[model samples]
Target: MDKIEEQLRLQVYLARCGVGSRRKCEEYISEGRVSVNGKSVLTPGTKVSDGDEVCYNGRPVHPEKEHVYIALHKPSGFICSNQDRDGRPLAIDLLSDATHRRLFNVGRLDYMTSGLLFFTNDGDFSKLMTHPSSHVEKEYVVTTKKEIPGELMEQFKKGISVQGEFFRLKNYTFKGTRTVHIVLEEGKNKELRKVFLSRNITLKSIHRIRVGNIKLTGLASGRFRKLTPREVEQLKNQALENKKNNRGKPKR
Candidate 1:
């Protein structure tokens, strides 16, 4: 019997073509920007075979020959996106000399927040890292414009909700009068800034130092390096482990 040809979801195909992560490609499909064989593809789940012609924004695309995973020390003031309409710098630009593949940041970090960030051309890895069930730990060092407020730490430790967004700290340690190291697993958007702002505290800086088992120990600011094969495997194993541990539990 002849083996059946694998059929891939349209969005997954787009991601293999380096058209951003699978989630981002889904958005592209929803916006009517993707096409198959000259016809618009509005559904992300639409399946296509290897022989089908796929186009993105009228340009044909194919899967990348090799997958690249990069760890970037994104500096403050640079956006994570590939393009910025306001002329702001982009973090992906730092890797222009490193590799030619279209790499998307696995998860986002705000322009003002800098540190360990992952970029990859593989969509499955991106999905695994960003999926809610993974619950991968992210460590950050937050510095305040003034002495770190006592109430702020207490509220975070005890969990607080402002404007319907919940803020909680898995663990925290005071490194200095105005600095604290905090770890979070949920990693909501701009969570640290939101928590600080809720208590009328101004943040001087927010820097991420770790994601799962990957640590930003010697990597310099505004530089990037390819992830070791062992590191990549460890990340996958850790996320899978976390997903297994959190099975049937509600996201907090």
Candidate 2:
């Protein structure tokens, strides 16, 4: 059999088909409403190759358009994802004034973790930003309950083994007595919280400041703006380079 040259995750392809957003696509899969080549897929990670038969609710699916990317200065209360069951505020609220294209946040920032959140309709771009291999740098400014010690700072920079998991901040520094800025290349759930807990430090708050080469930059919380052309280009180039680098490495 030939490879799926532009094959995407089945859930991702379902989302692209407008069955719903990506997250919802997973739920449909779990509910057994999605089928590839006539077989139901309950697993979320299955891949859907080009020309594959896809059906949802007994109907064929069509491809959705590439999305437009925007950076939102998400406020402390808004959820990072689309359509929360809790009915809490969502980042989409910030996009009311936006009329050009529908968008979705690339990655997530916890409702409590306010700051830069990327919104885009481009499924491929969103996929790139979230891929672990992208190695995209995400920077955050956080407040700690205890003062950061010098030794801990050095150790954080050097990396540590916690619960058999190796971790480190790509960069870390004390912003004040109980505050600091840290950068990481991965986005494990509750990762920052775990990083602090492992060091016996309590995380008071987390505010993301940057993603890839784009910074929040003067955008007030609860507000959003379309990405500039140059900013978009840089992100695409960065993702491309990361992909190329990964392709050259040996698989684990």
**TM-score per model over all chains:** 0.94, 0.79
Span of 10 residues, lowest total lDDT, candidate 1: 1-10
Q: Model 2, residue 20: what's the lDDT?
A: 50
Candidate 2's C-alpha runs over 4 A off are: 1-9, 18-27, 33-61, 99-102, 246-252
Per-prediction RMSD in angstroms?
2.4, 4.4
Q: How much lDDT does each candidate structure score?
A: 0.89, 0.78
Candidate 1, residue 57: CA error in Å? 2.4
lDDT of 1 at 41: 85
Cα lDDT of model 2 by residue, 1-252, tens digit: 224478788888766654555765788899999888899889998978867888887777766554566788888878866578999988877797885455566778887899988876666677678877888999999898788777776776787667777677788767798888889887677677777798899888999999999988898878888898888889989987987888868632
Question: Which lDDT tens digits does candidate 1 get at residues 1-252?
Answer: 112179989898888888988989999999999999899989889998867888888988888878899999999999989779999999999999988777899999999999999999998899899887898889999999888877778888888898998888889999999999999987888889888887788999999999999999999999889999999999999999999988988766
lDDT of 1: 0.89
Candidate 2 residue pairs in clash (backbone atoms < 3 Å) = 67-121, 67-122
